[model samples]
Target: CLGVAIFKKKDSVEGTREVYKDQRGRILVVEFIYGGMNFRLINIYVPNIEVDRREILEELKGLVVGKCIIVGDFNIKCSRLDVGKGVKVRWEKSRGIGMLMEIMREKGLLDVWRYENPEKREFTRRQLKEGTLKQRLHDKSHAIFNAHLVSKAVL
Candidate 1:
């Protein structure tokens, strides 16, 4: 059976998508596209406070394909600096977070905002005193890949 829906009253839509459960039990996949590009976006909610590095890596490997961009509130922290000094001091070296770093190194999918500007400090979790992030500050939690477009442009 195909799980498909379309709302084309005001805009053109393309492609088909399916949602299925995997062994780990806490993962969700949202596959979509825009401007003729394909994307495999996965939202993962990891269980087990201890880092299951291989499991996370394997789970990611299973979902990947051409022109992919995985996005979500990854339970693992990417960098210590993301959580301010006070919070940074409390976190022990988490092997699971380390695996996420390894995945980025193995995959050419660049964190788009980071690629464009390296100096920007990203803080996904914030304190109330810090105030709301201005609308301009919203792109920090995403990673984007454009190898498809780059190859096409080169040709």
Candidate 2:
């Protein structure tokens, strides 16, 4: 039942699959034309295991042309910057995360929320363990990239 839902404005013209589902119910991507600009919105759900990481990243690499905004639950812990308080965690270097970072660097994508709130500690999902609040990093991070000319009004 894992999926992604997109609600678009009525004026936008939709396009074909910029990226299709590499795995059923796991990845969904769409392209749109708004104000004469192309925008690709990727919605993904990476499993909480390590095996699917390569497949996910490969699918993502295929979809990185033109303007894109990738949004999804990447079930990997990639950075300490997205972690909040109450639990101490270290950043472990992984091949999947390294690929993702490389993609971001090569494609000119930015972590939208983290860019806006650099020093702030917040969590999109939190859990209580041993009577202490531990914020899990999965839902708290979203990777949003702007590849082409973005309007000042949209900023």
Candidate 3:
């Protein structure tokens, strides 16, 4: 089971509301008032398995409307660059990834880190209970935010 939440300064937010959540606890989305506009924070735990991951993404696509961000593992590599040095095994030749990219394109949600540092190859390494895998992209979480929404909430 996965859980997601956002902790913000008390005064900086208002009108907190939950937008969506999955039965398996895979996704959690909430809306709140910030900078005088409503913004959504979406967090998800994408399964490593390809088929399951794709199903979650499909259900999530419809919810990708308006002033929101979708953040999750997506369990995929957006491009070859997302794979680290000597990590060709990490590349997933899956259509689920393409669908995810399409969803992002339609909603204008950009992976914050990727958008900012296009030329840099960065990886966050850690040890899960199962084990540690170097140069793996899925373990790292993504913060996908609408570019327009980010710029407007500059308070």
Candidate 4:
């Protein structure tokens, strides 16, 4: 299961900051919980396609929380290396995704995946052969910003 919630105040945060579950029934939330010592966790699902992912980024910038560990599938993509290949007809329709990337940059949302895996590989759409959702470019099909997490605090 996935969850999305926004809180205004900073000091008002406490236990179970945000409640959510996973495929194996694990309770998840956003808060400062250090691993066996000190840390925090913040899970988010920035809207894509229809809504702007920047809103969430702005909200994060507005808040002054401690040791945040945000993790979620921010449905977005910028280049073909992120996904695979895309069709020009469908590529033109993914303007929202481009905006989401901009928002992420403006809000200082670092791509943890990119940092963790610098080799540059596609994580989703393994089934798409070579003519599904990509344009007729050299590398533009897997251009979706899917399955990733952005965070300011380390885990």
Candidate 5:
């Protein structure tokens, strides 16, 4: 199960709320509206083998709407933008990566962390048993249509 918890102010009232889950419980999407803005938060755990990338991508495409945030732990790798050290693994043409890039481009979504730190390297999760770390930019996509509404102080 993809467990999620949301916290808001005491006086806040949610305008909308929804949760989407896949049959295998691997993908979970939570959407809600607060402060007059809609927000979507997705949580995904993709295994390395036997994954139907096309189906997952189609499901994701169906969910994106207007200005929102989409986040998840995608196990696929991208190019150098997602790697830190060691031998560089090429993943530019991978189907999963390509699909993700397409979504970002079509929806005008920006990888918040990459946008803020262009040349920095960071890892979200580490495999302790294998002594391996992957610098995948999993949970950092956002569509901020109103630039003036977003202040540096909020970031």
Candidate 6:
């Protein structure tokens, strides 16, 4: 199941509220004020199916219009670098990655981790087949840290 969660307590940060969400329940965007500026936090869980992922990207790529940080399990690799060593490349993988990179570029988003650590690789896990990609997908500029894949952009 796809899910997005943001926890708020009575003492939690003020000026935080949900702004947008996809009817499909795959995306939930929240706006919050920090350092006297407003920014959006886009939480997403992209479907594994190629067709479904494409549909989500059609909507998600537009979310970078303002200052925002997007995070989630995209299920798709961002590039050849995202694929594990010797993994058999497939049409779906290539298609998905190209679409993702295209969206990032056209939207002026930056891949945070790739920009900072160009050669860095995830050290926690490895895959013998298919792929294991945890990309920090971003569009404009800023910063957000997370255990799951994450990225930031500023407009």
TM-score of every candidate relative to the true structure = 0.59, 0.74, 0.76, 0.50, 0.67, 0.72
Top candidate (TM-score): 3
Per-residue alpha-carbon lDDT of candidate 3 for residues 34-87, written as tens digits (9 for 90 to 100): 778777777776777777888887887777665776655555667666665655
- lDDT (C-alpha) at residue 59 in model 1: 82
Q: In model 2, which regions exceed 4 Å deviation?
A: 12-19, 137-155
Candidate 3 clashing pairs? none
Tens digit per residue, CA lDDT, model 2, 52-102: 777777777777667777777665545565556434544464436777777
User: lDDT of all predictions, in order shown?
Assistant: 0.47, 0.60, 0.62, 0.46, 0.54, 0.63
lDDT of 3 at 118: 63
User: How far is 76's C-alpha from truth in model 6 (Å)?
Assistant: 1.9
| lDDT by residue (tens digit), candidate 5, 1-155 | 34433455665656545577778765666666766766665655555553566677667777666555655545555556565567456565554777766776776666665676566555544554466653343333411111111112223
Which one wins by lDDT: 1 or 2?
2
Q: In the order shown, what is each candidate's alpha-carbon RMSD?
A: 7.0, 4.6, 4.6, 8.7, 6.0, 5.5
Instruction: List model 6 lDDT by residue over 1-103, tens digit each.
Output: 4477766667555598888888878888898876777777788777877788898878888776567677765666554455555556674646567777677
* Model 3 whole-model lDDT (C-alpha atoms): 0.62
What CA RMSD would candidate 6 show? 5.5
Best by lDDT: 6
Q: lDDT, candidate 2, residue 49? A: 60
In the predicted model 5, the residue pairs found to clash are none
Off by over 4 Å in 4: 1-29, 35-38, 52-57, 86-109, 127-155
lDDT of 4: 0.46
Off by over 4 Å in 1: 1-12, 23-25, 51-54, 89-92, 122-124, 127-155
Which scores better on lDDT, 3 or 6?
6
Q: Which scores higher on TM-score, 3 or 4?
A: 3
